[model samples]
Target: MRKFTEEVKPSRAVFVKWPLGHPFGEPFKVRQHNAVIRKAFEALKTIKKPGTIIDLPFRWRRDEDWEDKN
Candidate 1:
């Protein structure tokens, strides 16, 4: 719903290219979830303008470990 989010123009947002209902990564993956949350918090702190949507740098279902490099 990235396009939808764009239209809504929330004060701040984080966009992840993962499937719907799995925004925080696959179920039960704590590290992946934490990484996504961390980035969101960073956005929350760093975004200076309203309606800013931060496109996170995580790939959906990547082969390597999710939090290893990030």
Candidate 2:
């Protein structure tokens, strides 16, 4: 993630804890998407360091709901 961010070099980096492809949230989840966007915008306002990476504290799944048994 940092590698790609460094390569692209946006004004500020807002790192969400979602999956790789779902940057904001899942495809059809409006609430999740809004939350993400709101967080990102909030981060954008108060970020001090230029290239600092802020990881949003969120989880895509509950602890016991799904797991790879293998």
Candidate 3:
């Protein structure tokens, strides 16, 4: 779904740009998963203002580019 965090106007939020179902990254990519979780908690600790939205720096590989080599 489209990001609706703006409506909540949360005092702190972390927005990731990953695809719909795979917010952290493809299954089993531990490092990417860790980063997503890590930044979120960090945002929770650091954001001080209402409606603070932190967009993660991680980028997802395009659907066409993602490989199911596993």
Give candidate 2's error at residue 20 in angstroms: 2.2
Span of 10 residues, lowest total lDDT, candidate 1: 61-70
Model 2: weakest 10-residue lDDT segment is 61-70
Identify the leading candidate in terms of lDDT.
Answer: 1
Q: Which stretches of model 3 miss by more than 4 angstroms?
A: 62-70
Better candidate by lDDT, 2 or 3: 3
| TM-scores for all predictions | 0.86, 0.69, 0.73
Residue-by-residue lDDT tens digits, candidate 3, 1-70: 3258778787888887777888778898766667677777888878988789997656676433223222
* Candidate 2: tens digits of C-alpha lDDT, residues 1-70: 6578878877787776556787866677666667667767777788887876676666685322112211
Tell me which residue pairs clash in candidate 1. none
As a TM-score, model 2 comes out at 0.69
Off by over 4 Å in 2: 62-70
Q: List the residue pairs that clash in candidate 2.
A: none
- The lDDT, on a scale of 0 to 1, for candidate 2 is 0.65
